[model samples]
Target: MNGTNKGGAAPGRGGGLASPRFAAVMASQALSLLGMEILQFVLPLHLLNLTGSGALYGGVIAAGFVPYTLLAPIGGVIADRTRKRGVMIAVDAVLAIAMAAYLFAAGTSAVIAATVAVLMLAFAAQALYQPCVQSAIPHLVESHEVERAVALVNQVGMLTGIGGPVAGGIAFGFLGLAPIVFISAACFAASALVVAALVHVPYEPPARTAGAVATARADLKEALAFLRSRPLMWRTIMAATLVNLFGSSFFNVCSPYIVTETLGLPNQLMGVLQGALAVGGLAGGAIVAAVPGTLGIRRVPALLLGVVAGIAAIACVLMVPLPALGTYTALVILYLPTMAVCMCMSIVATSYLQVESPGTLVGKVMALAIMLANCVTPAGQLAYGVALDIVPAWAIALVAASVTAAVAWWLARAER
Candidate 1:
């Protein structure tokens, strides 16, 4: 955790509990990710069983993003204004309670209601928590370690991505949805505990500049104005937004059905696909870590190249005529490298933003970026959902891949 600062000032890095704090944060994040993955698996299965409609399954996933779009700004403001640890702890508690509610209620209507409620609350928490965590990293470690810290964060996410679904699938087969809920609840609760245990967070005095009502509006305005002034930030946001809109949307909306229907793959095979993506993500993180430099500066072109190459690999899967097993295996292979490269680039971009931006305004800028990027995800999902009716799945995927590649290329050039 002993590292450098963005300012190039080698401040006396505190040692007490830094290791423990890092461990606590990683464990909590891993648990939270596991919980989310379990829910991702179970929620769809629940929706499918309850409504027997693919659209409903899509809707369930879409519902989670709603708050990311609507409440993210508010969440950002609150995180900036409030104590991050307290906010994080409170949100974790709320999420735990929400999951508990879902566990108690078993039917479709109840599940939907619970899902909506949890998502609304969880989204609000995430909006606040994410910025807080991002902002807090600098406070916890030396500046030089920021990249590693960011990579570790991505790694934790990947670990959850790899493990959560597989465990959820197993749990689903034997113990059912309740187990998933219980696991999610446990993760949140554990995260809350970890937050409570954190002792080294450098305290920033409360912002005394603005009142609650006026301050919020001004903060939002200032944040937006700040972003407008930075062309690079705007371009980065645009690139991320477009990628999410096309690539992320298509994958989320189409992948499950593609596996279950088009590819005729079993649920277990789908789990493997998910796991493979995580594995790719882990590998990407390792690559990022091993390379010693500002990934934001050093690897931009290479990252974009990987993205283009990975997208082509994925697109190639569509052209290959293979049986279900072969297709699933091909997808797993394609998925790992694609996701790894994509995530590495994303991590670099995010770390760059966090490190380079003014600390005071970091929450607002990130919130806006998240809001804009997330807003497009649902639109992408909706567009693909409609397109699937008329267009072949492979055709839709090809378009998405092509669009994403072109956008990524444009972004790379624009960023440079």
Candidate 2:
């Protein structure tokens, strides 16, 4: 069955990103993820405006991460034990249903609660769905083409980042969240159908020698043991955790605060600023796809140095006397190179991990790595949220740049 049409074509036999099977996977992911990106952009801003509390905004956003972090490992276990296509289809369907219900409940007293709940469901689904897609990459393309395949998949997400935020901002500004919710539901439904009709992955029935919980425990133990043997795994995990803490968390909490509250900019501008990061990511993916041979894991530290500069520039611009629009423009411009470097480093490290891991354990191993790296993200978001209330945004940015510089220095030494 693994070699038959029932699953995807045999591993290493399919063409690179041009293969029809891999193309279907990309299309399916694109549909669902675009809807997700729109909602992710709109929901937090909507809540922030509604409540006018940065701390509350950060808390709600951070809450979604609870399920995301907890379910990631389980998602990996399920990815290994189940049909990958089925998992994708099911998760998309569930997301569609959840969003549809939220569509009906908008503007009601419960809308806020509904917003939080729907967001949690979306995050949880993403946790489960991503491992399936990530682990499926090696099986869908030639061994030599794995890095490009990874870049292509990443590019799909980045494309959505651009389109989703802009669309969401315009829609939320003019038409409001109801139409956006309706569109999101439709996208998820379409994604589920697409995956059902086209995408395929090699599947083998797991030998049921133990109960589900025991099997998951055993699988996690095995993954941990494998990770322990690879020092690269720990290094990558630590580096990623530091970036999430000092770099990404700061951006997430501060970006909306500065745009909507400090500058009093409209939702449309917020969308554009958010889309800048996506543009950077898309560009980075293009670079990786074009020149996979040059960027290696050892270069990850050097990339973070670019991020440090970006953050430092952001901090400096905030303190200078400038018009709100001028500051906004500067912030958007700085995010491009910062996020571009971040994405490149991420793709290189992930591709390296995928090539090194055994196929049987790839899903769990990747999930474990994701879980460990992201576990601190919620705390960072919360802390930044509080810091924004207590300290100036410029002060926070300066601190973030310094911490990132330290992490980059440590990563460079470790690589040497």
**Which stretches of model 1 miss by more than 4 angstroms?**
1-10, 13-18, 49-52, 108-110, 297-302, 413-416
Per-candidate TM equals 0.90, 0.96
Model 1 residue 251 CA deviation (Å) reads: 2.3
Error of 2 at 141 (Å): 0.3
Which 10 consecutive residues of model 2 have the lowest summed lDDT?
A: 1-10
Per-candidate count of clashing residue pairs (backbone under 3 Å): 4, 0
Worst 10-residue stretch by lDDT in candidate 1?
1-10
Off by over 4 Å in 2: 1-11
Residue-level lDDT of model 1, residues 1-416, one tens digit each, is: 12233432134452222476666666766766676677666677656545544566566667777877877787777766777778778877888888888766665557677766666566666777777766666566666677777888888888898898777766665676786788888988888887888633556665667678898889889888877897877777877788888877776777776776667555666666777878998988987778735465435546766666666676678668888788777777788888888778877777776666666766766787789778867667666766665666788777776887787678667755
Candidate 1 backbone clash number: 4
> Best lDDT goes to which candidate?
2
